[model samples]
Target chain A: MNKASSALSGLYLLLILFFLYIPIIVMMIMSFNRSELYLLPFEFDLVWYQQLAQNDQLIGAARNSIVIALVNTVIATTLGTLTALCFARYEFRGKRVLQGMLVPTLTMPWLITGTAMLMFFFWSGIGRGLHSILLGHVALSLPYVVIIVGARLRSLGVSMEEAAATLGANGWQTFWRVTAPLMAPGIVAAALFAFAISFDQFVISYFLAPVGTSTLPVQIYSAIRKGFTPEINAISTIIILASMVLMIGFARFSKFGGER
Target chain B: MTSSARRLRAIIGLSGPTALWLTVTVVLPLAAMLVFSFLTVVPVGGREAAFTLKHYTDFFTRPLYLTNAWRSVRLGLEVTFFCALIGYPAAYILAKAIKGRWREALLLLIVLPFWSNSLVRTFSWTMVLSDNGLLARTIHGILPFAPSFDLLYTYPAIVIGLVQSYLPYMILTCYISLQAIEDSLTEAAYSLGASRFDVFRRVILPLSLPGLIAGSVLTFVPVLGAFMEPRILGGQQAIMLGTLIENQFTASFNWPLGAALGFIMLAIVLLIMGLFYPVLKKHISVN
Candidate 1:
């Protein structure tokens, strides 16, 4: 009975994995296939990727995505880490309310948030473009960064900072020397997470991006809706691989499935 | 400044920037949306706009909008149901049957695709479910006399794609809760002459309810607002509340109507969270 149950478990897991991976694998293979019609007996070629390089619009969008993600990572990581440190060290009066405010950004659908930002930005004359996109991305990412870094701070405990104080180290000195180094792994992991969130963000960017200028995901969305092409498959395969690699690095630093 | 004053300053300096940013970007914008929802027109660029409740009333007065809202709710329920059905068992095996490095690696693998680009992932489904796509070809190769398996641009296609996208969330949440359960509890129940089904129903299932509830809320909320999956997979059949709202902003440029629709969607989401708050509070500690 035990053996039979275990076998059933393995089969179920394998089936789920197959469902998750099949589309990704199909897209990757089709990117390499020479057939425009996605025909079988796959003849491999690099033609679509070569075409992707010359596709100025796609190349430009990809550059915009990377730049926004990098800027978002820097801003979100700094703000989020500081917020996490505050939550870790202090017992302020409005801390609960502040934490509660973070929930809507995480739980509320991006469609609502995106639309709300559009309405507000337009009315307030902030308007739409890359700066508006950056604002939205940072708001979405800050909560995750705080959560990740806060978890690590909790694990590290207050003893080190207290000890630094006893040894005649000032608050600034202690933070820079002791707390910062100890929290480095968590901070790095959170930054990578911020980068991934901003990079992969679609719904928010979709709303904020003006005509002729957009992020890679927004550009890809229009390309898919307007026309179907293997060049899309080429760009998508590259994005999936990049995001997967970033996530693997995150899983390593954060021990995402928990410590062994 | 005194030492105590300096300490207070440090705390403010640490937490102030993030709080201020969230207030500007999240709190104020949502407030602005609420105000816009009550207006007759978008108050922008010399447009003649006035305060009115017509946009909210339009939702009830217009049958098309009402039906689309209902459709979105139903889609949320269906996608959440399927994700739980498939994910709970897989999470159980990973948490209980597997051990050491293998379990960790498998868990990471399950969650990897979730962080990748959702637009790309949704588009990939179009490749598999199209008439001449891989699924149909493989089905024909096996059955030989089977009908063409064209699953694209249908309700089932949307459901399938949504399930694939969200299944990892269910598994991850369930795995966290399941891993915390002790193996000896099951052994003890078995020694007391409880059957496997009885043990699971009475012992394991009750303990894991929080995770299940949390996963359902997480899955349902996003599925409620999903526009991309249905557009790519459902095609003409893809008119949910989300897509309707998207059309208002993107196609029609009726910002007030879109704002009203968005707030209604948010109210529904908040209601679900409130109903599940008691269960979720126990699972997710605030600090």
Candidate 2:
């Protein structure tokens, strides 16, 4: 029975990969198709991408997403790195509960968070603005960075920080010169993840965005709801490529794989 | 010595910022929602400053609301079952996969969708399942008897779309747990003449149950409040609790009612997560 089942296992592996990869590859192929309909004929053309570039609403949404994601990434990285260092370097009471922060912040559906944030802002007298969206995003992304960077810290050990203080460099300077550089790769990876999460968030931006301040994801959702076209496919292709490139770049930069 | 102690105190002081962050963002907003759920809704989805349980009473009294809530819960459970069913076997293969440079690439591929925007994934499904979609065209090409595919905005399409998107998460978590189990144990079971099924059932399955619980929580919690897939992918006939909340807020302009519904969904997810919390924290002893 075991020998007979080996053939079945091989088939299962093939099916799983096909299931995972086909949708994405199909989307990529459809993005470039010359047909106006988003369905398949596999015809080749770059016209949709060109159309994507010229569309003002698409362009504006893309621009807004880029600007917002960039700002959110920078702030989340700095504060996340700081917070991770504190968590990793020092042990204190309530650390367990505090560390559980990642579970809710990371796991709760983004739409729920968005609605919650919208209501909170209303009650607190803080009007809807980009800043409010920014605050909400930072709140969400920072916990992820902490977990990623904190893992790196755990491997390195605290001997360096101890050595630095022994050399009379003091805490701040040691962290700035030595620890920061060592942790830079993890920081970069965390930044990539943070930026991607923010860039793609639809609900959080949709609920919290002021009127006329739409992000790309929301813009695309509204567009698709109206109807389907190749332009959205083109935009999606770009996003897919962007994530792949970032993953490759992250792997190249980080020693997370341990120089193998 | 005293100064250093004060400096240590200052470093610990940073926890203040984290707590403040949680209060303003997570706690306060939830508190606001709770308060508003008891208040009155003005016209056009606006909230008035007053206290009343009329919104909850109205929502809970309606059979339609209860039906939608039940639909959402049942669908969530269905998706969770699919994730575990598919995720477990796939995870086993990956855990035993060739351990080299390709491993990260493989793992990254599994996680790739987690990085994509919800809107894009749901919209992608719409394109595939639309009335004139490639799927319908292909079906038409194949057989004359096959019904014309009108899958978009339908229940099956919503499930397929969401399951495809979030299934990666279940696979990855399950893969991690499976890999953490030592191969020696499996080898021992094998030498003892235990069949592959027996080995898996007795040794591997128990070892990875914790991960399964975690994955289910991860999948089901979001699936409960899932708005994007149901709205864009599930046509009008398939309304979910998430969609109901969205309609109340955006269309019906019933903020108080929407708040009540949203909290209801949140409560369900929190309850499930709470039940699974202990399992997630403690490691399962494979031996």
Candidate 3:
């Protein structure tokens, strides 16, 4: 009976993996097709990649995405870390409600937040600009940062800080000297997620962006709207490959330096 | 000494940044939108002026807007159901996979789609389902009389696209909760002569409710506001709340109406959360 069940489990695993990944593999292979139809009468060509490289509009969007993601991520991560520390280390009135409010956005739909931010920025007279756009990303991404960092900090006990205080370390010094280094791994992971989220965000960026400034996802959406060019596929493959490399690199580094 | 008073002061000091951020970024903005939604849309060169409840009333009265909103809600439910259905089994497998070799591989495998951009995923799906595309040709080759299926730009295609995009979240959440269940609980059930199905239904299912709730809500809420997949995959008929709101803001040049619609969405979300939380809470085993 156990053997039969185990075999069934393996089948389930295989099926799920196939469903999840087969589309991606198909897209990657089709990216190089020299055929105009974006389908399987395959002729391999590097033309799409070349087109992708030279498109000024695409390049501008990519630069915009990178700059916005980096700027927003840094701000979100710092604020989120501070917020997480407060939630995890202290007990106070309104704490439970505060925690609940912060935790859900780690999973909240982006659409509402994006729209809300768009309106917020409109009211603030940042109705359209890069700085205003960054505000939306920061708002949406901060929730993720807060949740991850809070969870991480909670897992770390406050005993170390207490001991540091006993040895004459002030609260600020104890936090800096004792807790900050220990919380580095979680912070790094939170930062990475914040950055990834900002990098990949579509709905928020779409709503908040000015007429001229656009991001990569926005560019891709517009390109597909115009027509699903083979060049878009090529660009996508590059983004996927690059992110995978970074994720793996982070995994390796965390294995060593972030063993804490 | 004033040590305890100083400690209380320190905690307040520490909490300052987060409190300030939450107030400005979240609370304040939401308040602004709430006020904006109530404003009247007086045509001022692609915008509105003056305060009026017409947007809200028009939104409630108009078949065009409410129909789209209702459809979006239904689609969100359908998408959530399927994600839970498929994701639960997948998550269950990952949760129970052998610890050393297969587990990490399984976990990473589950997360693969997330690493790929959602637009790319949706586009690839379009490739599969489009006429003369992979799926149709394959079906024609085998069935020979399946009537050249037009899956692209249909409701099913949107659901399929949504499920593919959001299932990973469900799987991840479910896997976390399922993995937390102690082996002994199940072992005891087995030792008591419970059948495998009984063990699952009685012990496992009940225990996994929290994760299931987590997964479903994550899948459902955003999907209700989904714009792109329906547009890209479902085409014209796939108009949901997100798409309609987009039209209001961009194509319609009615920011007040769009903002009203946005606030309506916010209200529905809060209402749904209130109504569902208690019912959902009843299902879980509170620790």
Candidate 4:
């Protein structure tokens, strides 16, 4: 009976995984199909991918997305790492309140946060465009970086830095020589997370994108709303692959879903 | 300089940029949204504006907004219920039934897609659920006499898409909490003559309730504000509070009304979180 139940549980999980992956797999397969109408008896073809390469608007949007995500990664990681260091090393008045500030972006729906950013940016003359989108992306990615790197810092437990100081190294020497090198893997992981967050971000980009220009996601959203084409599937397949690759890198460095 | 003063300076120097960035991008914007919700107009382009409660009042007076608001709540509850139902068992199997390397690999696999582009994943559903899509094609291939059907542009399609999108959150949270349950406690229950069902019901379930609650909140709040999935899958049937607020901003160009609707949704989210705070505090440490 126990063996039967265990097997049933395994089968149940298989079904769930199948459900999770089927739509994504079907989407990828259809991207390679020759038919624009998504008809069956799928003749595998590279026509859609070739067409996607020629699409100037999508190509431009993709360029914009890459640029924004890269910039967002650098800025959010640096600032967030610094803040994580602050939280790790200090016990200050209003520290809890300061940390509480990060909760809104983490917990609140992006719809609310996106619309709020839209209103404020437009009103404050930040105006909608790549700049505003970058700002929003950094804000969204910052908390994740802090949380991930902070966990790493906490695990390091300050002992190494303390030992360095006891050996007559100043704060600068200790941080550069000991702390930074030790924190390298966590920083790399957090930077990858920041990139993925910015790259995969759609809602904020959608709201903040200026007229006639957009990030890849915002562009994809418009295309989906207008109509689906095999070209969309091609771009989506590429996007999913890119995001998964980035996340895999993050998982490797962070030991995500591994032995704690 | 005094040691305390130097420490203060270090804290400011390290944290200032992030604090400033969040203020301009998140804190200030949310504050502006609150102020916008009370305005007579968007207060742009030299348009004279006055404070008014009409937008908030409009939500109460308009049956359409109220009904859609309730629909959004209903959608949240349904999605949360389904996620918990589907995720708990999978989490349990991963946490308890499975062992070692396989458990780690399966957990990673489950979390992988969740980190990928949600927009692309949501769009993927259209291919499988649309009329003459893959599911219909497969069914027809197997049984030529079967009737053709599509699940797209329906409430159930929305539910299905959302459940898939959010299920990993439930699984991850439940798995974390469940893994913390000691094997010895369950062994004790068994040795004390508790049946398998009794042990699960009275022991395992209670121990895992915190994760379940945390996962439910994480799932429910976003589902409450979901727009993209419903738009892609539910078509005209997708007019929940999310889409309604989206229309005010994107189509109607009514910023005030959009802000008001957004706040009402935020209020509901906060109310739910407040209610769950005591339970959440005991089990989850989000940071």
Model 2 lDDT per residue over B1-287, tens place? 69779757765665557657766878788778788788775322353367787766766798988898899999999999998999888888777744776666666667666666657766766666778876787798888688886988778888888788778889877887888899999999999999979998999999998888888888898898888788787777568788878777567867678788888888787788678878755422100
lDDT of 3 by residue, B48-96 (tens): 4677889889988999889988998999899999999999988887777
What's the C-alpha lDDT at position B192 in model 4? 100
Among residues 3 or more apart in sequence or in different chains, the pairs in candidate 4 whose N, CA or C atoms overlap within 3 Å are none
Clash tally, candidates in order: 0, 4, 1, 0
- DockQ scores of the candidates: 0.79, 0.44, 0.47, 0.75
Models 1 onward score TM values of 0.98, 0.91, 0.90, 0.98
Provide chain B's TM-score, model 2. 0.89
Off by over 4 Å in 2: A1-10, A38-41, A93-97, A100-102, A166-169, A251-260, B12-16, B42-48, B140-145, B282-287
Kindly list the per-residue Cα lDDT of model 4 for residues B164-207, writing each as its tens digit. Answer: 99999999999988989999999999999999999999999999
Candidate 2 chain A least-lDDT 10 residues: A251-260
Task: Give the lDDT of residue B126 in candidate 1.
Answer: 93
| Candidate 2: docking tier | acceptable
* lDDT tens digits, residue span A1-260, model 1: 49998888888888999999999999999999999999988999999999999999999999999999999999999999998998998888888988987888888999999999888888898889999999999999999999999999999998999999999999789989999999999999999999999999999999999888999999999999998789999999999999999999999889788766
lDDT of each: 0.92, 0.77, 0.76, 0.92
User: What does candidate 2's lDDT look like per residue over A14-47, in tens digits?
Assistant: 6776776666776788888888866455779999
User: Compared with the true structure, what per-residue lDDT tens digits does model 1 show for residues B3-71?
Assistant: 789878878898899888888789989999999888888877788889998988989999999999999
Question: How do all the candidates rank in terms of TM-score, highest first?
Answer: 1, 4, 2, 3
Cα misplacement distance, residue A190 of candidate 3 (Å): 0.9
